[model samples]
Target: MQCVRPLWGLTAAAVCILLLLLLHCHMLREGQLSAGACEVVTLDRDSQPRRTIARQTARCACRRGQIAGTTRAQPACVDVRIVRSRQWCDMSPCLDHEGCDLLQNSSGWTCTQPGGRVKTTTVS
Candidate 1:
């Protein structure tokens, strides 16, 4: 009878330990599941304003005859090369006149001019 009682107590202790271990594992898994709620915030405005300025300058210089130091009522510097395309030309203004060209090529909308010379101004 003594041997049987000690064996049963040992069995009970073992079962209790197993249950505690299972509970600990479940709590750990639940904590990990909710951990995804923690997130990292990011800023997307990295040098975007500068890139926009450079792109605008390139687009503006592509127009025909809107170069600096020329006084003429020339054709519209900005032209829609293709009606279907949404690409539009953007040019920097020089002496009350802005020069830009929207030209559609086979690959895509390509704005090209000589040496990319334009009157740079601060865009507010």
Candidate 2:
């Protein structure tokens, strides 16, 4: 009985930690949304683009009506209306032979050629 109680307590602690992490992320997201500038979260290929509070990278920032995006594997500020249109892949962003995969966040996408070459395009 004593061993079971300790195990249950450990499980509850783990759940609490997870919930705290989620809450922190949510707060961070809410705060960043109101910021006028864009922030670069990660430069890695295997991750999603997340907004941060810092203003260190000027290139990632967008204009008032625009949002952080990427063009041809480079950071760009795309118009908000265009982003919502959901027609990015139709614009042939990738090479003629490569396939374009739009990311869920609409922040950027990845282009993959038949030879397994992958290019990750990311926004702030």
Candidate 3:
């Protein structure tokens, strides 16, 4: 019985060490110290009271060449190239006085202005 207890203790200690090593490896792969460490700043304005509220919310801070994942509940960092693979017209729309058209190569979409200039953004 004494030998069994010692063996169990050793097994438990090994499992704990393995878990810690795995967690450290995951953190290193993500290039973050810990999960939920990054924060996003949100600004809210009340028109009636003419007041502005600034709040810091927890979010995955993506590194360069990375973007926020599509999931809202558990967002993670994703490569920008994955986002670019999506259809541009599905995500972007043409603004007023601009004509929306698809690319000739069918690679993406484009918005052209009345003055023969290209529109890159929408009106706020």
Candidate 4:
């Protein structure tokens, strides 16, 4: 029947589309296609503007010493170096004479007093 022929054609088209989608997904999983690079961003928190944050990239894995982070905008990789480069202290206020220091082996920064007292802020 003519109707049956059209139905078969449609079915074939649909199957082809499904197969294409599956192949695309498989390529993405295998990293043959680049999902995208994670973006560094600054966020606003508690009425303070411009706090640096890393959001995890979609379908991407971070390198060593980095963790996936999510923001309102997108996902990125978070690390101590990224936080320090963003100047964590400028966003976080410290005591009159306290200085902000980036933790060497962590994904956060610390406010250090002259007497060695430290207040740490962790970014996820």
Candidate 5:
């Protein structure tokens, strides 16, 4: 029938589109293609490991149901530096002071510039 010919054409087109979608999903799962996943990683330098930093999780998909390639986000990051707060206080007062033409007062130091006003800094 003439009507059957058009129906067959539409069915073939639908089948072809469905097959393409299935193949795409297969490729993604096999890692031949790329997909998005959240993970935490550390930073390293010259084969040496450093301190642990914040854990960042990134997603590639938007609300519209789309997938992004893995190469776009490989989590290439750097290490974090951890330092003690007390170590900073151990340094001398003169080392921390700057831009002072003179030093005065036993409890605090004065910062002054030529022909400028004087500022006092108390040691904490």
Candidate 6:
């Protein structure tokens, strides 16, 4: 019937869209996609404004198992493994007045006390 034909077309279109979404998700899961979720933040006050407000700042609002990191020199969501592979101590692995040294292997970090002694070794 003519009505049946229209209904079937709508269903087919929906299926196609769903397939595309699934494929995109698969690519993201495989770390083949560079895309990430971004969010906006707003601040308001009833009192007088302070000095001034800058244009805006951007940061990655990543999903679970993901952290804000740089990819291709651009802000992006990266896996925790990728972050740990580097020696930068962005995670604040060490407490105040302590020094953090990344292990040779990317498995963990070590903290040094103020007296330059090994305080603790955190194995990831």
Maximum-lDDT candidate: 2
Q: Residues 28-106, candidate 4, lDDT per residue (tens digit)?
A: 6665423334543354434334444333224436667654543322455556464546555543345567777766755
Give TM-scores for every candidate, taking all chains together and pairing residue i with residue i: 0.28, 0.37, 0.27, 0.35, 0.30, 0.36
Tens digit per residue, CA lDDT, model 5, 1-84:
999999999999999999999998898776542333433334343332442322334333222232221122232111111012
Per-residue C-alpha lDDT of model 3 across residues 1-124, encoded as one tens digit per residue: 8899999999999999999999989988766534433444453534445433332233676778866542222235556775666544433345556666657665544578778876332111
Q: Could you tell me which 10 consecutive residues in candidate 1 have the lowest summed lDDT? A: 67-76
What count of clashes does model 4 give?
A: 4
Candidate 1 wrong stretches, greater than 4 Å: 33-124
Off by over 4 Å in 2: 1-59, 90-97, 102-109, 118-124
Which one wins by lDDT: 5 or 6?
Answer: 6
**C-alpha lDDT score of every prediction, in listed order:** 0.38, 0.64, 0.55, 0.58, 0.39, 0.59
* Model 2 C-alpha lDDT per residue in residues 1-124, reported as the tens digit of each score: 9899999999999999999999998997775444344455555333346523222233354667876554444445677766677656644567678889878877767789899877755544
Please give the ranking of all candidate structures by lDDT, highest first, separated by commas: 2, 6, 4, 3, 5, 1
Clashes of each: 1, 0, 0, 4, 0, 0
**Residues 8-60, model 1: lDDT tens digits:** 99999999999999999999666442321221223233255335333222112
User: Candidate 2: TM-score?
Assistant: 0.37
Model 4 residue 25 lDDT? 91
Error of 3 at 64 (Å): 23
In angstroms, give how far residue 111 of model 3 lies from its true place: 33
Give candidate 2's root-mean-square deviation (CA, Å): 16.8
Comparing 1 with 5 on TM-score, the higher-scoring candidate is 5
Q: Which runs of model 6 end up more than 4 angstroms from their true locations? A: 32-111, 118-124
Candidate 6 lDDT by residue in tens digits, 1-124: 8999999999999999999999989987655434465433344434434433223233565778877653322345767765856743555656677776777775555667788766333333
Q: By summed lDDT, which 10 consecutive residues of candidate 6 come out lowest?
A: 48-57
